[model samples]
Target chain A: MANILGTNIISSLGFTTEENFQTVKSGISGVKHYDAGTFGLPEAFMASLIDKEKLNDSFSELSIKNSYTGLEKAAILSVFDANKQANIDLSSGKVLFIFSSTKGNVHLLENAVSEQVCLWYSAKQISRFFGNRNTPVVVSNACISGACAQIAAIRALESRKYDNAIVVGADFLSKFIISGFQSFKALSPELCKPFDKDRKGLNLGEAAATVIFGKQNNSRIQLKRGAIRNDANHISAPSRTGEGSYRALKNILQNIDKGQIAFINAHGTATPYNDAMETQAIVRAGLADVPVNSLKAFFGHTLGAAGVLESIILMKALYGNLVLKSLNFSKQNFENKINISTENHFSDKKYFIKLLSGFGGINAALLFEKR
Target chain B: MNFKNSAELTELYRSLQIYYPKFFKMDNLSKLGFLAAEHIFNACTDLQSAPDCTPITSRREPVEPREDIAVICFNRSASLDIDTQYQKTIQDNDNYFPSPSLFVYTLPNIAAGEIAIRNKFLGETSFYVTEEFDAGQMVETVENAFSDTSINAVLLAWIECFERKVEVFMCLVDRNSKKSCIFTEENLKYLAINIKFA
Candidate 1:
């Protein structure tokens, strides 16, 4: 089995995995409020905007910020940080780079410079940083892009293809993405309250997360199984019956014992439809009683980075033997009751499930085991 | 649903007698993917032979249906044609209204969703944006999609549209094929560029 050797998160709260994990664990949120000037909104909106000064400060330490785009800077720095901790030689040809991003360098679209708007160019440039030999694989399955990348890496590793896989997901909030969400009327005016009765909508955030997996055991966490299911229900709205997500959960839970699952890290975007669908899905899968939580309250919805960053946090939570609190979860919102942890809880079990559903009626569920 | 190379995709729709109203609302990229998928599915499954028409989802029955086919797609310019349209909506200072119709098709994966829904492929579907048609990356990703034991076949599509030109190559990869050619980068590139391959 491939083991996650190293992980790092470049989020609003902090730059390193340990730093962001500790900040969120301490019940401190990184989400801040900004008005009309930001993203050109007519009204105010809440988002987990990464502190530019803090990022610039940390990036200057690496002294390589100027050469790359803002999104690329975050990704390269996070992967570099993970490599620094794990001592993985990214330059080695034995490593396979799998990059995930919904919209990379898309901010260039405002200038009408259509030539550079391609995600392929951005992916190639990022991989060149490590002097990697193999052509990198870019997954663009909307929000599930990151989780899909890890699954792809696991599959490639099982084929005895590459020695290690550097799975990095990054997306920056440009006027393009923010305006699109605003047009959908999916952005919450206040801090997102996931799994709450008063939950209005989601807040978009930008982040980059990295996980290094090797065949040899170096880290405690192991990815057991993953499944991606399409709803075939609608383009943007998830199935009200949770058909797609339920199927994904059912596929991953086939051989595994339900009792072994300690907690579930849900997508919980705080959007009415998404939150409701997740509730029905968890309950339908018979995982309703499990301690379920969402990290959007801490970092908001980081789009492409949500899956990878949340998975990294899950590894940290499982390694630390704690169920990270689902911040802003106060009241039950759905007809099917779910166990959303209001406060941080302790658990002895070593396995957990990660769930994410995206715009293209896509749903993904992954099972993780810690040794 | 016969497969053939035609510059006029509308002619295929007329020939097939396809009447899905949503097809008209779709952008050129999605229309290309939808048509390519329609032709491939008809060929892979005996659509013409079976008059009653058993869905592709049920044709591979008794072995479970959902994970039977994984849709893997790649593109060069992505949704460049539709993106230009969407950009114009928000670009105009007086209009300032972003048309949700155009906004939805901006991502290339929406075309993949259209294919999955129409074909009823419940398994994994991922879209990769490539600068150019790189056969190596497409072949490697297809191998990864087949890792799941339940994934019996992969509908690999290389759909791209930029300016007025559109190129779509949809190949059905099933291990149960009697006359199936070897799955390789060279074979894919040859088949993609050349429309007619028996």
Candidate 2:
């Protein structure tokens, strides 16, 4: 198992991981009514938008070229944090970069059409910025991209392909993404309420989060076991039986005891199909009694960034010995009995699992333990 | 896993071109995927008997949706349709009815979809996009697939579709072969060397 030295988060909640943790501890809601005149999205008010120009000014002049200012800064900060704990040099040693995002400057497309200026190019641009010319992987598995990115990084590390890996998951609000989600009727007009009986839909948010994984230094968290499985049942819809999600949980449990998992960070999108499917999967995994919380209420749905964004929060919770409430939960939706948090509290257990499901029936589960 | 000759390889490419002309032109990822699928189909003549032909059929046999057959594709350039979709949306006053032409190709793994729908082999399908292709990850994917007794064969390819050009190297690997011979960086280079560019 590779050790997670540290995690850094840059989101609408706050710029740094510490700041974001403080916000989470205080139960501060980062979501707000978005009113950008330039985009002409007045109806879409609630969102978690980062100050792009402000973030760019904080970095070197060369880093501000593309729309990856937030992602670049987050990566540098995470690497810096990891470097402080471990005795490793990134320049001399190989570092596998696994980046997850849904829209890598998809906003750039509205202005012009060029193959050189797409999301994959942006990933290369980041790699070049960090002087990492080795193998860099960009994962875009829709909503599950972030979790999938972590799984890929872990596999790379276990394969001994690199000494350490820098995993980043970032996505920003763009007219392209906003319009797409709205067209699908997946966007919420008001604040998102996960697991709530009256929950309407998700409020789109943007964030960039970075986590460094390597040999266990003095880090507090360790990624024990993880698994990614496909439902193979539907393209846009999740398996009604939650068979895929259940398989992921079952696979992870095969290596580790099911009771060892203290909490669960679910892919609670506040959608009818997604939430119901996840609930059924939890029941099938026999984790119905576990305490689970959905972070989408606070961060909205960051899509590709959700995995890292939620993971960062989970790390902070483990570090601070706290389990934040599920934000908005009125009553249980179905017969599947599971403990959903409605208040901010801490837990004694150290191990937890993060689950994510996306389009094409893609499902992934990651197990994390405090070092 | 080993190819007999370059002529056989050219025939595989020709088959892919005939099936998906638009995708073949869009980038090298699709072209390579098409080629790889054709090679795997031709190599495993016995498994080709059980086809689940549906609306997405391209060949006579339906590609079985079992654990034994897996489609693993890698790409450096992610989405090729985002640019086209963005242009159409902006020009059409951002009216946001997704361009089906662009949306159809937005998925990096739709090449697997094309192959699955055509071949009707619905097994384990996975798509990975890396900054550059990693030999270790490719080998790991193969190892994982082979761990399953049901997955006797695996189709692996490294496909890149960027700018206007496409480059692909695909192969079929089974328990019989100690290592992959059809799809390696060296074999791909060999195939590239044999191409007579006018």
Candidate 3:
């Protein structure tokens, strides 16, 4: 069994995981409408952005400022803070680092600097910052990248090839990414409302989150099941039936009991198809009534970071017996009868599942339990 | 092996007898992966008689849909072709239209998805971007994939493409194998750099 030793979040709300989670539990949204002129678009869009000035200050306090890109700075600072929390010797060879992001250092293309924008180059630099000797594995599999990384970390620890692994997922918004969503009309001009009848679309956010997985050490949380599958339905949109997500959910549910599941953290991107697909998958997996929450309204579909960031919140929720509300949700839009948590509830549940489906017809599900 | 280097990607696609027209739509990264994985399936099926058969095009060797197999790939440049294309649309003032087609391939794992679709692999797929084709790291990563207990086979690949520099390497890891190439870094390096995978 691989224990979740530590977790951290660096988002628009605050630096630490506690700050981000508590602020969201209170129902304060960081997403705000920004003028199109901010990014040279024709219309305004809502996004949750990290304060650049504050980020620079935090970086300098930890390591150095202006030496790394905003992307690298965020990644480094998250891992640094997480390492301090876990008290793990990152410099040792017994540790593995897996960085998950759809885009890493690709924003550098905006400037004329022309630095190498390769994912491996950035991964090497980031892993070396923590003195990790083994080559870092960089996963760039669309938004499910974080789920994929966690599964890898669990597998690595279980394989006995490494004693511990740090799985981090991060993505910073760029005009290129924003425009892609705009092209697809996927971005909601207002805060996204997940699983609601009036939901418009998803809102993108910037964040970097780290989760440390260690060998059995009496840790309270453990990663139990991880499964990734493709829809083979469509490149950008799967069939409305949620075939891939169902397969992933079913694969994870094979060894898990329905009663033991405390709650489910779903990837409710709030788009027309994404949420419908997830709810359908949940019902198909026979988890229609189990409490479900989507943190995208709080963190704004943080892309790659959504899986780990939201999982960390669920971990804390399981620990504190707090089932946070699915923010911005009012009515049910999905045909499946899922109990989307609209109000905060308290319970001592042992198990939780995280389900995430992304672009490229990919779906990933992870099962975790609180000891 | 019909294709030796990444430069032969275009010619390699032409040489293969695959019916999937989507092969023409993918970026160079996806093309490299589809073709490299094609080579591995060709070997696994032992389709030596299917003259110059790439994995995707060769139908002589019928293999069942194996959920036991996992896909793990490594590369330095993740989707540079599509990245360059998407960046081109946004970087300049005149040619600023972020085509969703190009934007979709911006992440490197789309290649893995293409292969999974063609092969019907429902297992876990991981795209690892590394500084280089470090065999030790690849070996370790492959072993970790097998630790899941349910995974008995793995489609290990190092399909890298950047600025016309193509280095496609794929190895099929069988958990029950007792051969000399028992999923080791040295053996991966050997198959990656020298000789066609038998």
Candidate 4:
């Protein structure tokens, strides 16, 4: 098990994890509708976009001379805040940095195409920002990138390859993404209602979240287990039976008591296929009665940042003895037995599972326990 | 079987008689990786028969969806070739017709997905980006994937395709293989740099 030393999130709701958590607990959503021509898209849509001016001001406060891209700035800001809380020496050779993003510096391709457009270059530049000695590992497995990176950190820590790891997941909204989703007809014109019968589709959002993991720490949160599996079904569509998700859940839930699990944090992008698939997986895993919640309504499916950002929020909620409701969820859409709440409640459990499924038919599950 | 460009890859696919018409829909990057993986899978199971008689598309063996093999690929250009293509579709508002066909292949891991779908591989599928191909890193990643007892074999590769240049070097390493050459940093480096066929 690896200990979670610190966490931070930079999203539309706020700039830190605590702020975002509070905003979520109060049932505030960051998703807002934008008219045509917003972000260079031709149609109107809803998304939770970060304020560029606020981000610039906050990034400038660091007094860094180098001009980093918007995605890099958010990532650095997030890692800076998280490392400040952890107080760990990132420059140490024993520390590893893992950067997770579906697209990094991809917007640069619009006008300029250089070595800087490479994801590895962006990761290396981000690691260099903190004077890290080790080269950063970049994970680009679509939406599962964040969860895969965290799983990599867990294994690295367990294997004693690095004493500590700073994993940051960040992705931004662009015409490239917005247009793609629009073409797929996957964008909902209204606020995304995850797990609700009336749910249409998902809304895009941008955010950067950091999670610091250490092998030796006094932290109470421990990343106990993780598993990644593929359905081998379809690249762009989820499996009808949720085979990969069920196998992932089965792998991590091995030999563990089910009662300790406080709740299941689902991907719940509110896309019809995605929500239905996840429900099938949960039921197949025999955890149908466990209370589940999806943060998409509040975060608007923050792409790569969804895993780390949502994991941090669920960790805090689990430790606080609270179960945050799945916002905007009114009724169950799938014919499975999934216990979803639209109202907050109390839970004294200590364990929680964070599940994420993405393109490429990949599904990942991470089990975290608070001691 | 080293291909220098996409044109040569198409020629290679046509000559190999890979009857899977879905191969036509894949982007250049996916086609390169898919072709490389087909070569490796064929080489392993002795399915590479005469071009005209054997129209091998999918795995000929009747095997269940095996979760024992993992596909881990490293590349310098993470789907930038397709990214640029998708970019052109939405370059301007008047010409803005974002094609979902091109957009879905934007992520690099989709190449691995194509391979998994073709082979029915339910194992872990991951794609990593590095500045350049590093044999040491490739060996390390292969070793890391083995930490999970579920992965019995790993299909490790360094598939790079940016613009006109395309290169793919894939090898399947069975954990229980009693082959002459054991998997090592030196062997991996040598094999990646120099293409030697048995």
> Which candidate should be chosen as best, given lDDT against the real structure?
4
Q: Which residue runs of candidate 2 sit more than 4 Å off their true CA positions? A: A36-45, A60-87, B1-70, B90-96, B99-105, B110-125, B130-154, B159-169, B175-185, B188-198
Q: What tens digits encode model 3's per-residue C-alpha lDDT throughout B14-85?
A: 777666788878888888788877767766654221233223334545444545667877787778767777
Q: State the lDDT at A60 in candidate 3.
A: 88
Q: Against the unseen true structure, what C-alpha lDDT does each candidate score?
A: 0.81, 0.67, 0.80, 0.86
Q: Could you tell me the lDDT of residue A351 within candidate 4?
A: 87
List, residue by residue over A86-197, the lDDT tens digit for candidate 1. Answer: 7878888888888898877777766775666787777777788879977888888888988888888898788787889999999888667777787888989888999899
Best by TM-score: 4
Global lDDT for candidate 3?
A: 0.80
- Residue-level lDDT of model 2, residues B38-142, one tens digit each, is 665665555431243222243445444443456677766666544454446644444646443444355666565455434534354567775455665566656
True contacts kept of each: 0.50, 0.18, 0.66, 0.76
For model 2 chain B, the run of ten residues with the poorest summed lDDT: B49-58
By summed lDDT, which 10 consecutive residues of candidate 3 chain B come out lowest?
A: B47-56
Error of 2 at B71 (Å): 3.3
Q: Give a tens-digit lDDT track for model 4, residues B56-149.
A: 3446655468777789988999999899989999988988889988999998999998898888888899999987777766776777777777
TM value for model 3: 0.92
Each candidate structure's TM-score, on Cα atoms with residue i matched to residue i, is 0.93, 0.82, 0.92, 0.95
In order, what is each prediction's RMSD in angstroms? 3.7, 5.9, 3.9, 3.9
Model 4, span A1-371: residue lDDT tens: 78999999999999999999999999999999999888788899999999989999999999567578899999999999998889999888899999999987788878878888888888887888889968789899999998999988987787677899899999999888888999999999999999899999999999999999997769988899888899998889999999999989998998899988889999999999999999999999999999999999998878778889999998889889899999988888577869996679998988899999998899999999989
DockQ scores of the candidates: 0.54, 0.24, 0.54, 0.71
